[model samples]
Target: MVVPAQGLPASVRIHEVGARDGLQNEKAVVPTEIKAEFIHRLAEAGLTTIEATSFVHPKWVPQLADAERLFPLLDDIEGVALPVLVPNERGLDRALALGADRIAVFASATESFAKANLNRTVDESLGMFAPVVARAKEQRVHVRGYLSMCFGDPWEGAVPVHQVVRVAKSLMDLGCDELSLGDTIGVATPAHVRSLLAALNEEGVPTSAIGVHFHDTYGQALANTLAALQHGVTTVDASAGGLGGCPYAKSATGNLATEDLVWMLQGLGIDTGVDLGRLTATSVWLAERLGRPSPSRTVRALSPDSHKE
Candidate 1:
């Protein structure tokens, strides 16, 4: 559907990141069966675009070392887009071998973040993705590019808007079907989100091909997401139970909560197709597995015990 003149789309698509982005940084080693169950439950809660896992090296992200084992189990799940993160050509090879049709690659918008996360400079990281993107297209796999630290960086302070637009265009040129702009450090305000989206639009990046991923470091995730929605960002990334932070960026914190985002969107009369009560229950259940109370206010507010069912 076309974005209205106010720039908000009638419906929004949520990219659920709980399985991959959410769990990757968790200290506890979540078992393979549990991870698979998490993904299934997310789909059952009406999330169609759930990011399942990553193929990054075990030494780097031990939490997701079970990607190879996890992918096959999820192969039969229908209607949902189960995209996994592939850090390089090797990861892509593993994913393609398993007949994984959807994959995501991450690139940093700042040099310090690139070095810390991928051990490469920004240009070098893009160079690595060129071949990976090419190979994925050759294999008819869908590719989503993740541009991290788009709003600000820990070491570098505020990131220039132009830097994000440049990297975003490069990823699109390399054949990414969409780009998820990340506020890795979660320092972005609504104004910052608007300016960035405007810059990207000026550079000819269609709003339809862009998504926003925010963290609630300053409790601004939902507000920033609302700003993006007003600017026509249809796809927003959120994690169940508000579970995620960038391990490479210490200042980063929990992602925007899926239940919280759903609550806001549904109240705004935006269709997300998610069952709020079921999604909240899923987060509560997953939080139990993680041995902690969920960080999501919506989940806590809607939970049966907290408020009368």
Candidate 2:
């Protein structure tokens, strides 16, 4: 039943964000123990790059306030990469103190978002991240730059491709090892996705160094992801069970579901090293803890209760 795709990569590296981005927006803080177990289960389910937590201030995202406590519990997990989000130098310091070698800095593609999210102008925020990226690179830490609102901004409406390219190039110039283009409000269509990738290529940003992080706000996450894959982007940012939405962008919804992405990749005969059944089960287990059904269609379809009625 597998249909091979002509242009897609043979294998995709899924950057699982369930632990950090997924739980950060939750009104109810998931306990440190549960968060640790969630990450452990994700590793067991074959997610090699799991974003463990953020080192942002507790006042900003209280849900992940237990990052200090949660990260230590994941020390015994081997073979999987645990990347953390560092908002500033202090955040980076905290993550480094906990032995985190991989970190991501979130950036905005539009001025509206930059002001709303970081309380600074786009250039100012980049200036803030300059030293952080420089410091991380000094220690040989892998740094990923997350460019949000690449396709469209809630306040700015349609984002110019050139504007995105400028910021993306800036991040790479800051010595980020990789860049994850985020459709923060999920307004990206397939053509928009392709155009942006092509534009980045024109600006000397290779497709191999870019990753795609799409939201399902318009139900275009999968479609957009397909466009990125066809462009030779191998890294994908997905949340297990579709568990995350932007806390800053009110219009943004849950991220592309890992289960949904896995199903599509499996059908396309792409190797992701993920066990779909185990991944679905872990999402189901976490849904129970969150006291709601998983928003992911693939998870809901394969879940045990789906067959009950």
Give the Cα lDDT of each candidate: 0.91, 0.95
Task: Kindly report which residue stretches of model 2 are placed more than 4 angstroms away from their true locations once superposed.
Answer: 304-309
**Candidate 1 lDDT by residue in tens digits, 32-134:** 9999988998999899999999999999999999988998999778999989899999999998888889999999999999999999999999999999999
**What would the per-residue lDDT of candidate 2 be over residues 8-76, giving only the tens digit for each residue?**
899999999998888999999888999999999999999999999999999999998888999999999
- Candidate 1: the clashing residue pairs are none
True lDDT of residue 200, candidate 1: 88
Question: What are the RMSD figures for all models against the true structure?
Answer: 2.8, 1.1
Tell me the deviation in Å of residue 268 in model 1.
Answer: 0.5
Poorest 10 consecutive residues of model 1 by lDDT? Answer: 1-10
Give the total clashing residue pairs for model 2.
0
